[model samples]
Target: MIRGIRGATTADRDDEKEILLSTESLLKEMILHNNISAENVASVFISATHDITSVFPAKALRGFEEWKYVPVMCMQELDVPHGLSRCIRVMIHYNTSTHQSDIKHIYMKNAVSLRPDLKK
Candidate 1:
């Protein structure tokens, strides 16, 4: 079965370095929490708030050679009133036997406020 894992993290700024680091940090945490391997990931959808224009979060995802075969897409999040800024959100679809309730969704840094229920 295909399961979806969600994760979000806030970047210090729109700078490339900060965005890249923030994205990588979030991905690492999600991978660790969910006990997931890149080979099992079918695709990843990443979106960043409009404030984040320095770089595409998917660029950071590609930093790992393991993602060479993974289908990853990046998009700009709709700017909603009072939405978190400089936030990168990702939904990873993977084939796994784990139940949806067993999937660990990660929310780190200021992005934790976005998903209080999933916050660690």
Candidate 2:
């Protein structure tokens, strides 16, 4: 089976360190909570709001020695009125036996408020 895991985080600025930290934390939590291994991940797509351009969030994962082999891509999110700012979002496509409903999606820090329905 194939399932998707979602993760998001917020940063105060579009700095490299901030983007890397938030993206790393978000990906780590998503994988840990869902008990997914790097080999199980088919691909990862990351996006940042228009306001963020310091660095590509995907690079953080690519630079990680453990996840260097995982396929990752980054893009700029569509700009819309009242859209979330300084946000980095990730979608992981995993080749797992788990059902879609069993997958855990993480929205951390201020980003958690963006999806109150999943806070529990």
Candidate 3:
């Protein structure tokens, strides 16, 4: 079976280092909470708000030793009115037997407001 684990976080600023670090932190939390391994990840899709243009959030995944070969893509989030700013979101497609309701969706930093219901 296949499932998608979703996560989102906000960077302190638009700096490259901040973006990279923030993304890495969010991914780490997602992986830890879901007990996910790069080997089981089919793909990852990341998106950043228009205000965040310092670097591609997907670049953070390469920092994980086992995630270097994982397929990943990056894109800009739709600039919807009143949308969250400096936000990075990720959706990881994984090969797992876990039921949908059992999957953990992570929301951190200011992005917590984006999905208050999913906040742990």
Candidate 4:
């Protein structure tokens, strides 16, 4: 079986390091909670709001020694009016035995408010 783990984080500022660290933390939580393994990962797609252009969040994940070879991509999120700013979101596609309802989704910092139902 396969499932997707969704997570989101917000940057306190427009700095590249902030974006990278926040995204890394959020993705780490998602992966840990879901027990996702490198071999099971199909791909990871990341998107940042227009206000975040410092760097691609996926690049930070790729730099990690454990995930250096994982397939990941980053893109700009849809610029909808009044949308959240400085936010990085990720969708990890992976093969898993867990059910969708059992999957954990992480939303951190200000992004937590965006998905209150999943906040922990």
lDDT of each residue in 1-120, candidate 2, tens digit only: 778888899987889999898998898899889998888888899999999988898977876676778889898888989988999999999998887777789998778887888776
Those runs of model 3 whose alpha carbons end farther than 4 Å from true positions after fitting are: none
Q: Candidate 1 at residue 100, lDDT?
A: 88
| CA shift of 100, model 2, Å | 1.6
Per-model TM-score on C-alpha atoms = 0.96, 0.94, 0.97, 0.94
**What lDDT tens digits, residue by residue, belong to model 3 across residues 13-117?**
999999999999999999999999889999999999999877888888888988988999999999999999899999999999999989999999998998888
> Which candidate ranks first by lDDT, i.e. highest?
3
The list of candidate 2 runs beyond 4 A from truth reads: none
Model 2, C-alpha of 15: deviation from truth (Å): 0.9
Ranking by lDDT: 3, 1, 2, 4
Please report how far candidate 1 places residue 71 from its true position, in Å: 0.3
Candidate 4 matches the true fold with a TM-score of: 0.94
| Better by lDDT, candidate 4 or 3 | 3
lDDT of 4 by residue, 7-60 (tens): 898999999889889988998898888888888888899999999877878877
Clashing pairs in 3: none
- Candidate 1 — which residues are off by over 4 angstroms? none
Winner on TM-score between 3 and 4 is 3
Clashes of each: 0, 0, 0, 0
- Cα error, residue 57 of model 2, in Å, equals 0.7
